[model samples]
Target: MKFYKISKDSGKKIFHFNSNFIMSRVIQTDKTTNIGCMHLEEGGVIGYHQAVVPQLLLVIAGEGYVRNDKDEYFKVQSGDAVFWEKDEWHETKSDKGLTAIVIESVELNPSLFMPLKK
Candidate 1:
């Protein structure tokens, strides 16, 4: 079994992320799963982008808003969880500073589903 402790200062700032935001990668698995943390200061914004793989964002502290490609906005706070499908366009912002955990697959297509046919 493995253990991890994630703190605001745990990892390094993610490359290519918005300057107003801080992202740190906590762990990466051989199976291509990545776990990270992000910090968004007041007025910080992560511009619209699409993830190549499914992503799960769990808010651990503070408050923020997430916007989808359709321009729908959702408020999030500590203990809130958000999931984004692969290739889904989304963005995030914080008005009161926010911290969150991000988990995603590194594979191009990690999920599979089969449709039932008649």
Candidate 2:
């Protein structure tokens, strides 16, 4: 499996990717465990999508709203954290901007997703 060193800052080497929304993965784990950070631009909205694996998102900066397919929604701001599981449909919106840290862990085998190398 692949491993990446976690850093507090996004460096020039960081790869940009488009998931539910445009995001930059800071540190990514190729094992069952994963960690990452993302910057959501102002007025950005992450479309409804299911994560490939279970994840936890912690708001690091800015404000936003997270919505699920079940019609449930929640306001998200700095210092808030949300749990996301594989195959669970959800979306996110940022009226201003948002920076978040995401973490994930899988019990079974995992796949590697390195940005830019593809």
lDDT winner: 1
Q: For residue 67, what is the lDDT in candidate 1?
A: 78
Q: Write the per-residue lDDT of candidate 1 for residues 27-56, one digit (tens) a residue.
A: 888998988889887887777889778887
Best by TM-score: 1
Candidate 2 positional error at 22, Å: 3.8
TM-score of each: 0.77, 0.67
Give the clashing residue pairs of candidate 2, or none: none
Return the TM-score for candidate 1, rounded to 2 decimals. 0.77
The pairs that clash in candidate 1 are: none
Prediction-by-prediction clash tally? 0, 0
Model 2 scores a C-alpha lDDT of 0.67
lDDT, candidate 1, at 34: 86
